[model samples]
Target: MNILMMTNTYLPFVGGVERSVQIFTGEYRRLGHQVLIVAPSSSQQIPSDETGVLRVPAIQHFNGTDFSVPLPIPGILNAALKQFKPDIVHSHHPFIIGDSALRISAQLKIPIVFTFHTFYERYTHYVPGDSKALKKFVIALATGYANLCDFVFAPSLSVAVELRRRGVLSHMEIIPTGIETELFLNGDRRVARKWLGINEDVFVIGCVSRLAPEKNIDFLVLSVKKFLEKRRKVCFLLIGSGPCEDKIKANLKNEIIEGKVIMPGTVTSQPLIDCYHAMDLFVFASKTETQGLVITEAMASGVPVVALRASGVAEVIDDKKNGCIVENESCEDFVSAMNWVQGWGRKNNLKRNAINTASKYTKEICAQKALTVYEGLRRKNHILRNHSESTWETAKRLIKAEMDIIKNMTRATGMAITNK
Candidate 1:
């Protein structure tokens, strides 16, 4: 089957959504299916021999401390859709590129599917107060498009619930963002620690995400500070870069925890897995995530996660089992959870459980489930359209037969009256 994946950003523009699309599309291709990706063009575009990538021209804008938006390339996208002629159009974001895909899907009468990756309502604070109204409006627009789709895929149950709350009672499927299991298994903790110059005795608490306001990096910083107040031998490793890198640095400076904090900006998959391997614990305080792919990545690397009970994160993390979940957004709770993980002293058990949990969310498994949903949607659409067409044909035949009988009756009646 030919599948077209439309996303706002693609390779080289790193994020959870991009990673999810990459993994899913890769798996789709591995299954001997043709896959095409449509995304905003970057400076460096990777070539795909089997899978194709069509980059559309777009304008980029930075919103808050670390968030950016890519406006849609309308004309280029329309032309690409005409040439690609995909069997299915799967969209990641429900705006901009997602909208373009929806429109093209309609024009071509192709089945469209959407994966609700981000909750725009949660990030409304990024926009100005007066513009806040646009948040609900944007959600409404997304819902409109979602209703038109063959199926709407949510990375977590929480996302699916939110879509329902927003009146998107249409077809919704819950699938978690998956991770590459073998990559984490290949990581070497000793080598990773030596590369980062992290001491052997210090307990490493790490966060892998874009350093941005919506991520609540401040909470992680404050919680680490609180943890250091008692445990001075702990190190905090923050991976990934964003607009808030300097601000986070300044904040760490203000707290005078520079020595304890390590910011290695944006490493790729292997190094990131190694960083996770080197860490004793993974601390993620971001409340805005739909699925928190990094949490699963850390878990796959055998690092226990200390995260808030927010959004779809709960679906991946079983509190006190694989990882500890802080019920509230309080820094004190985060610090307490960190201390709990430290005192648990069952590092091996926690790590084992985490690996087991993450194993369940492998890319191949997720892709299979997603493909099942896509196949079901295709079948359903075919059945529905066929039934509608059959009904229309039956109605037309009935009308034509009735008209013929009426004309014969009128002719007979006219002849009888003329003979009389």
Candidate 2:
């Protein structure tokens, strides 16, 4: 299959959606499919190692923003689409490149899919309007864009419900992005702790996410402050950099100075895996994730989670099983949950369960599941292509398509068994 992915961000951006798209592209290629990515030009030059990536002209760079608006050069994009003749187009966002994807899909009579990656309601501060009004507008925008797509991919059931509630009547699939489980699983904790200059006796609580107001980092700081009062041997490691860095640092000035909190800016690849290894527990305060990919990464590293109960975090964690879940957003509740879980009696069992939960969401499995959805959509489109046909003929074609799908699935399963 030939696949075209359009996104405002890719690769070097170092976010969940970017990483998810990269994983999908590579996995599709490994399965003998052709993949091409169209993304906005970054201020930084595209790395030589990146292949099959085409850049659009970027017009402005907002200092604190995760994206740049690429001038929609229709002629250039049209030429590329014409030459590729992709079987499907998968867009990562609702606006920006997604609008371009919609245009090209209409022109070429191709089916397009969009993934609902963010809970835009939580990001109202970025726009110039009342928070309530901005949130309503964001929901409307998401609903309108979802209605235009041939299919919508929701990373979690909660997101799917939200899209439906906002009037997304289009076909939707609930799919989670996969993690590179082995990368985290194989990291050497001793070496990682040594590299981070962490002492063996000190218990580390870590959080890896973009520093942003929407993430509720200030609230998390408050929770950490309360938790640290009793457990003086514990420290917090805050990873990743974002627009809220300076704000968060100022908010936690005393904690930073006292060595109770460490901000490592940003780290990637093995270094990122190493950070996960050095932590005894992972903490997440964000309620905006469509799917908490970082939570899974931490679990795959055999580190249990202690997170506020919200959004996809609830989907990935079972309270007292894989990890501890704070019952409310209150600082006192969060701190209390942390203290309760720090007892160390159930720590080993929780770690084992966390690893088991993460094993179910590997990159390979996610790719296979996504491909199945794509194939099903393509088959449906193929069966419905002859609009001039009679209703009886269409019915016959639908039955034939279903039979083909079943046969293909059975044969594939047999092949896997034989190989095993």
Candidate 3:
């Protein structure tokens, strides 16, 4: 099967969506499928030696954000795609690169699959205006994009229900971006503790995520600080980096200076996995997560998590079972939950249950389930352009694609204004 996957972001930028696309693409190829990824052109962080991937021209770091905006499609795109003859185009975003994916699918007359990875309404602050209307437009825009797709991949059940509420009429599938359970399972606790210069007899509270405002890093930092002050020989293992790094460091300045807080900015690969194994508990406070990817990774490494009761976090966490889920967004509540997990005899049972939960979302199992559906979609597919479409015909198709995308945007705008 020929599968064409398109997204705004890719590897070297450590996040959920990028990791999802990377894992799925690799798994599909291993399963004897031809996969081609159309992504933004190589940035400073991106490597030049990527295979089964097509790079399009893009403006890096748009509006001081981590995202890259794809430029207009070059002529070479049509030529390359014509030869590939993709049966299905899987889109991982809903704007910019997503718009480009929509156009490409329209031009080829193939069915497009869209993954609802994030709640668009929660990310309005990234834009210039960042008004209530802008949030509405973003929501409507994502709903429109989902409706346009032949299938919608909702990362969690909460996301699926939200999509249905926002008027996404397309067929939906609950396929999470699966983790490699073994990769996390094989990490060494002793090795990670030795490298971090921490002793074997210390309680470690850990968090691995991009430190951004939308992620609610400040609240987490404050809550963790309060938790640390009340305990002796307990450490916080903070990983990943972003704009909010300085705030976190300042909030926990005395603890960090005293060697009680270990801040390792953006660790990956074996070291990252090992770090998970070294932790006794994982802490997450992000309200915007579509699916708590890192939560599963920590659980796979035999660590229990205490997190806020958000969309994806609620479903995975069984209170007094695998881990404790805080009922609200208060710092006191979050800290209380953490304290509960820190109790002895409670940690071991939670660790066992956490591993059991993580086992259900492995990369191999989720990939096969998605691929089975893809095979079905391919067999029942239809196309507009044949194997021998002319250059002029392709150009005409592209022009029509532009018009369709523009109309989609307009409809979304109208829905936003009318509150429909």
lDDT of each: 0.77, 0.80, 0.86
104-185, model 3: which lDDT tens digit per residue?
7877777789999888788778779888788888888888888878899888899899889878999998998888998898
lDDT for 31 in candidate 2 is: 90
lDDT of 1 by residue, 15-120 (tens): 8888988899888888998888887766554555524888667554444333335565647665666676677889887666776676666545568888888877
Q: Name the TM-score of candidate 2.
A: 0.88
* Cα distance off (Å), candidate 1, residue 372: 1.0
- What's each prediction's TM-score? 0.86, 0.88, 0.94
The candidate 2 region of ten consecutive residues with least summed lDDT is 411-420
Task: Give each prediction's root-mean-square deviation over alpha carbons.
Answer: 12.1, 10.3, 2.3
Per-residue error for 169 in candidate 1, Å, reads 1.6
- State the RMSD for candidate 2: 10.3
On TM-score, the stronger of 1 and 2 is: 2
Local distance difference test, candidate 2:
0.80
Candidate 3 Cα deviation (angstroms), residue 142: 0.5
Clashing pairs in 2: none
